[model samples]
Target chain A: MDTIIQGKAYVLGKNIDTDQIIPAEHLVYSLSDPEEVKLYGKYALSGVPPEQGGLPQGNIPFVTEGTFHSDYTIIVAGPNFGCGSSREHAPFALQVAGAKAIVAESYARIFYRNCVDGGFVIPYETSVPLTGVIKTGDELKIDIEANTVTNLETNITFTLNPLGDVFSIVRAGGIFAYARQENLMAQS
Target chain B: MAQTITQKILSRAANRKFVDTGENVWLNVDILLTHDVCGPPTFDIFKQEFGPDAKVWDPEKVVVLPDHYIFTANEHAHRNIDLLRQFASEQSLPNYYDVGTDRYKGVCHVALAEEGFNIPGTVLFGTDSHTCTSGAFGMFGSGIGNTDAAFILGTGKLWEKVPESMKFIFEGDMPEYLCAKDLILQILGDIGTDGATYRAMEFDGEAVYSLPVDERMTLCNMAIEAGGMNGIIAADAVTEAYVKAHSSKPYEIFQSDPDADYHSVYRYNVRELEPVVAKPHSPDNRATVRSMQGTKITKSYIGSCTGGKLTDFMLAAKILKGKQVTVPTNIVPATVLVARALECETWEGVTLKKIFEDAGCSIALPSCAACLGGPADTVGRSADQDVVVSTTNRNFPGRMGSKKAEVYLASPLTAAASAVTGKLTDPREFL
Candidate 1:
């Protein structure tokens, strides 16, 4: 796990549900097949209304057309991000699209758990709203150890809530790895 | 040692005398539910973590129901069913509901109830968010992601944070126009989408207790819409009767202590509540059906784990008895049993199925058709810029297909009334 992560930001509004992150229509694809798994990246966040996709200016696609990976790697959003559905595919799609971390006001429990338990991406909760302050494409760096995210473009840093009990699990990569680390499961 | 029903249930699952709210504790899961959409991926993870030849911790404890994406031409969707069959065969699971067979069930959540998987004092975890629907049985049920589900597949246990419950007491008798859907929507409108995040929503009061098990399930189904960990109601005679009718398994009932602690308490009078709809793109964007009346709609759909139950159909049948729909309306039963019930269940000497057919509504084969806007060929899926009034939960953008399309979530009565006028109509108009 990377302690210091940096990337361009993709900002979105509140209540950005799992459906929008990865539409149900595309859920039919196999998650384990190497070839088919890439499709998750292709359609990541494709369900957000065009006018609210990338936020601030809006209408900006998170994953560019005719491509699988996204240019922006960090997501900054309003409260209750990933508020609907319990699809692990949402965070998996984001990770496949190159997002490393998300700094939001809050997140739905299932999505949050998926992020850590799947080792897909780091979910960071901010004390204050970062949507208005951080524009899309703004270069940002997250310091996991310090629990802070800095907007390199504006040189502004925001404190994030501590990862607390789940940090060790996150550090181990995912629940399976964490279980192995703690001898909770027999290693195959 | 006062505790809410949720805490008590968790305590029992944890093998503890008491479990404090916000305390993370490992629970012995009684049942692990999965469906087509998530079952395959979960199996993949389970195999990857556990050895390739390793069997499930307990085949009897795992319930797999293939409902989503059924009846679609999409090869991937069909492939998912094959994967489920393969896994079930390998694991020798006793509770696998396959598609294209008499054993098939429409939706996982509803099927769980019909198959007697829902029992009070038990803990259930499913890959689908609507798993909370089982909380109506006075059980602890919450949705988990594939990773967590996979963990449970290998071990019959998973850790969960004890949720501080929020008490919602609905006073007065439920009016003629109101159903469980209206009561839940009323709460959504007040609390917004994230109102109950990481918390238990315990429904109480005389009005809540008066509802049948099916209606109680409706109230709990939408708890996820409010970001609730679970929505629970104490098991009473009604819940007990329903459980006993479906299963011979012995079960214990638990209730919140008199001095139980709660995160918050909300009071509502059913007499003052009205039929409501969650308009365009969000479940929290609620409006009274009367206020949204005449809003044009191109389609009306009644179905899903949330709204496709027999009781929901009964409500719709009452509204569509002798009326012709002005738009394309689709009636989808939540499960195979529900589909059969529509044929046998009657009101005023007319079966529920005939009521919809006579009203110009198309009754589709039971499955989660168009509720989540599945495959391109999904029945009742919305078209570009199409406005639909549906009995399904969630109206997020592109939820029912067509990114430009809009969905208004309403009760079966409101959906049927709206179908008659090709617009959003209050159920009170028909009642």
Candidate 2:
């Protein structure tokens, strides 16, 4: 848990579904095998219809061709982000592609759970839509301790909704870690 | 305290007398379902977190159905099935339905009902989003990610925030042309995709009860599309008859109290509703089939957990009895049981299989083929810029195969009728 996280932003429109996050075709690869796992990163957000892949101008790829990682580590989007599917692969792909945080108006429930429970990316909800304010390739900083995101390009700051009940789980680095700390799982 | 049916079920699962909406509780899960797509990773995480030799919380309580990507030549897909087999064997799990075996089931959601795993008053959690389909049987069923599913696999328990309930009442007799697909699409159009987020949708009224169990499953199956935590219909004699016919396991029935509270209630008259479709790119992008008529389509697909059931096929068969499809149409059953039923079940004294074949429609072997744009070799996958009218749920971009393609999510009636004209056609045109 780094309190201050900063990176280039990748902005997207509303209802960025699981299929668009990681296309169903690329879901066959292993999430654990180090070599196979890179495929997840290579194809992350590959189904976003290209024109809608990146915000503002669109047609910008989230991950560059032939690379497993993305230069943009923060994703800023509109409401109802990650609205379809329960594939944990959605968030895993984003994390594998080097996304550190997501600032959106809201999220689909299962996707939100997967983000925290899997300790993949920090899904932060904002009261205002950030997709319009942040441009792809714009620098952004997320202060987890302060619960605010600042656009380094515009020097504008926005308040993010508190992580609330799931914050401890996210802070503990996922359910398994939290469970162990709370002694919820029996020792082997 | 007057609690909604969902609250009551959660209360029972949490071993508490009452559970309030918005409060989190650790629930004793009745069943944890998984399939090939998510099962391998979930099993891997289970081993990584719980140790290599850890046994499941309860073997019988976990159901693994290998349906997705089963027929694909993709080696990774095959490897996933092998992993499921390895894990199931290591844990001595009895509910494992392996591919290439007699016990193989196609889609996990529909198969859960056919195999008697969906019992009322119980709580089910699965790795697949459509697991909420089981909630049709007056149970609490919701989807979770691999982490939560693996947690349940290891502990038989997981945490959940009790959802507020939303009531939907559909009155009057269900019209012949309108099926559950239309009714659900109507709701989606009204509420939009994320309207019911973190809420329980309860279906009621004469029309809902008049529907067969399979139709009810259709209503609940797409609850996830609305971002609903679960969709439930109280158990009636019809539910009991179906459950009794399928399983001998004892179960409890629960219902919402007469004075229960709901976040909101929506009312509709079945007579006022018409065949509708969720136009391409989004499930909430709904339009009346009549309004979208004459829209040319390249293909028609009828299959998946949502639309591949026997009742769905029966509806399609009614419209395609003697007509020839002008476009390529694929009929894939959700389960082997459904495939067998198509051979025996008759419409106008003709078996559905013969009807589809005679109508020039291709009937593929059962499994979730092309519903999710599987491997390149998947059947009925949409080609570049191809427009498809499909009975399957979710018409999201690239859902069937090609990102350039578009899909119109409609009832089997609409899909079949549209297939006849190679254009989006209202079922009423043929009915």
Candidate 3:
């Protein structure tokens, strides 16, 4: 069940607050709709949602929904992602939406773990240059099995940590499927 | 080898006689505390990562409260509180304080000490950075992420980087208008937020000894802005009495050796220090509030975990007994205990809330309402309407909700004066 996401890598700027993660309005009753949560970056995609959401949204968010990397599971951001509040919901919404891994310059200590503890999402660190090297609509091919990221534009490839054996199964879906597979193998 | 409190805790956690730089240590957390904003997230992760029957190490060692969003601005936040309550119900947690529920009240910092949930000489961690406030109780406490916090809940242990020590020896006498809030704000303005990154500040010396436990707590409470593991004032008789009064647990005293290695040492002669402010976008940018005098202020906030102490109210109340706030001001106690303490003994001869109320100042609950920008508090509406004044900690840009609206860092007294006059006014004038 190893997976890799490669496409134009869209860069969401740094310090994206939790309210911007899923927005207080989209939250339906008590249930968090991850499908809709994915729309959080919409303002960034066009620099319109924040203005559309009220405040004059600036170009800083760097939203690129229709751009090449918009569909990629990997998002590279600046330092201190999930900086404000101790909200696990931010990462929950991120993973539940479509992100498989988040590569940031750095992460807020609390939010980073909430992401990992929630599921097997890789949060790696790299130089800030990676943001410019990545372009919207540029397809990045990542091999979940090999733990490598390849830039189609530069033909450069980088290796990342394996999702760990325990997470390899959980990343396939949830713990139920993971435990089911482990149990079936044991029976076999 | 002489043992300091920090060294003792590190050695005990590392299972060694001494610790070296860059050493990995496993330490048992003395207490695990969290607030509403942090509590639910950790619970969700605990449920998924550890399973339902997961055993929380010591229910009695755990303290959880609702502070960040106590009233729940909307339905979603309410559901989040419900989840935390459900988790608490199942775990039989010893110290669970729901908002406005019994005496389990106010800022997380005050509540933890009030219920005797925290003991000196033990290591504690919470989901909030101000958890360092507990270090004033003479124990090592720091803030960590939900991930690390999750492991603490499921495993009761955490791996820590042995923090280097920064010693601050405060000597000399306090001049007329100085207090703990002013001292720490000056420290922040001097060092900036990154000054103590990953280090532990040890407050010692004559002035530190003279400081009451409550004032010392204020010092450690604001240490989070220094970006350190925790700020600790080694235990003395003052600490012992506080611990014995608050908890029945046996206590031990820990101190550092005179020859103990240090990353750095600082000496402050506060006799010459003035009320200072670190301007916006940086907590280290220092300037005297007097220099920024006459700076127009729109909204003034005088309470949060850091600024909201009894001495805080008393100091401001003494000056405000016959005065009024210049602009609309909000003087809030960090917790209900602080509010209640203010009501005790017409101290300096006047109750704080009553004085504030008479002055047309609104004294609110013991919540972190405006500090965290938790609704009803934002600095500016497009730079055109931004307000500026000094507050308790670092003023990183947009830290208080408006990137353009400037935030100035200062002591509670400076803030109180500004609130009264609606402009950046010095406390010296009020006195």
Candidate 4:
């Protein structure tokens, strides 16, 4: 895993739930089916606001086309981010959308665990609130080893708490790979 | 060292004599539950990571129920169930409950209790947030993501962090008009949504123990709304009687030590509480029904794992016996057993269904019908510009349907009285 990650930030508000991350309507796809799985990436963050259809009062859209490429790779949000539902698709959607890491003031437990278990994205817990400090389209450098996030645009830096075993899991590319490396699962 | 109920349960599951807060340990999961919405993705991951030829650790330990969107005829919805059935058959699973069949149970949380899978002192994981409902049985129940669930399917074990415990003591006698829903809503209102984040909310004291198992389930079901890891009540005669009636599985009960460490403690005198409602867009934005009296409602809903139990239906029926509903009301039983009980249950020589139907209310089949807002064709979903007073747990924007629609979360009694008046009327008015 890269100890230092530099990417553009995507800013979101408080209490963004799994439903809003990837609505239940788009959960019909199966990973085993190639055709169905392709829809997941396309529908990623499709519920974000200003995008027509679904949910009358839409939320602020971080990724306009629901696809994250070179720009807008890190998500910075307020408290209780990813609050509803136990859908791993929330993280999978963000991972497929190219979110390298998420720096939030606080997170709902299930969403936090999903990100770590799936190794889809790195969840950074910020001791200081990042909502006001970080802005959309800002270049950021996240150092996992130092637990520090620095704004490359300005020289401001925020401290984050190490996620204990989560660092190892992300380094190994998810729980499945970690388990296999430790011989926790039977050999195929 | 003294241990709380959560500590004891996790210790036992981890096969350790003791475990402390913030410590991560691998636990042997006794039961893993999944539904249509989450099961397919979980199964997909299980197959992909474990390889196509890999078998489940124990088929009997895994329970699959196609509940959430099964009632709808949408092709995608059907495809979800089809995939679950295909996977269950491939694994030769024993506990697969198919919809449109007699074995079909309703919501996975309710079924987990009714089927005896919620044994005390064991760890249970489900793909839905309300899986904490099983904690009412004195078990350690929490929700997990598809990846973690897939790991459990292959290894029958998953990692967990021991959380600090928050003890909530409900003292004094509960008033006749109040139920578990009001008590929990009151707590949520006071604590705010994230007050109990990453902690276990342990319910106790005279009032909590006096509640029936089903009512206790309602209290634990909404713990997730407060951002709690789980909500648990120690096993007592009430819990034992319910578990014995439904399951013959061997189980053990655990309790917190008197010196158990608690992050915080809260007390509530049930006698002073009233029927409260969580207003539009947030479960913690609460107000007493008396204060919000006459707030117009376009529809009324009495269902979901939180409020769609036999006790909830019975309470609503008592208020709607002879009254006609002024708004469109939908009554959904949480489980097949609850639906059957409603059919056979009578008040004033009329079945509960008859009373609801006579009051101009419609009853739907036993599933999570419109609680999560299934397909657009779902029976009771709220439309644009609609204001609904419902007994469902969440009132988040676009939770029931249409982000423009407003939802007021309430108890069944409050819901019934609101339906009769087409406004948020206090149940005490009808009583």
Whose lDDT is higher: candidate 1's or candidate 3's?
1
TM-score ranking, best first: 2, 1, 4, 3
TM-score result, candidate 4: 0.96
Give all TM-scores, in the order shown: 0.99, 0.99, 0.81, 0.96
How many residue pairs clash (N, CA or C atoms closer than 3 angstroms) in each of the candidate models, in the order given? 0, 0, 27, 0
- Candidate 2: global Cα-lDDT? 0.94
| Candidate 4 error regions (>4 Å) | A46-60, A65-71, A186-188
**Sort order, lDDT high to low:** 2, 1, 4, 3
DockQ of all candidates, in order? 0.75, 0.76, 0.17, 0.54
Which runs in model 2 stand beyond 4 Å of their true positions? none
lDDT agreement with native, every candidate: 0.93, 0.94, 0.66, 0.87
lDDT of 2 by residue, A1-188 (tens): 78999999999999989999998988899989999999999999999988887879999999999999999999999989998889999999999999998999999999999999999999999998778888999999999999999999899999899999899999999999999998988642
TM-score of chain B of each: 0.99, 0.99, 0.94, 0.99
Tell me the tens digit of each residue's lDDT in model 1 across A108-141: 9899999999999989898899899999999999
Q: Write the per-residue lDDT of candidate 2 for residues B273-357, one digit (tens) a residue.
A: 9999999899999999889999999999999999999999999999999999999999999999999999999998999999999
- Candidate 2 CAPRI level: medium
- The candidate, 1 or 4, that scores higher on DockQ is 1
| Model 3 chain A poorest ten-residue lDDT run | A47-56
Top model by lDDT, which number? 2
Candidate with the larger DockQ of 3 and 4: 4
Going through the candidates in order, what fraction of the true interface contacts does each contain? 0.87, 0.82, 0.16, 0.57
CAPRI grade of model 1? medium
Give the range of the ten consecutive residues with the poorest summed lDDT in model 2 chain A: A179-188
For model 2, report the TM-score of its A chain: 0.97
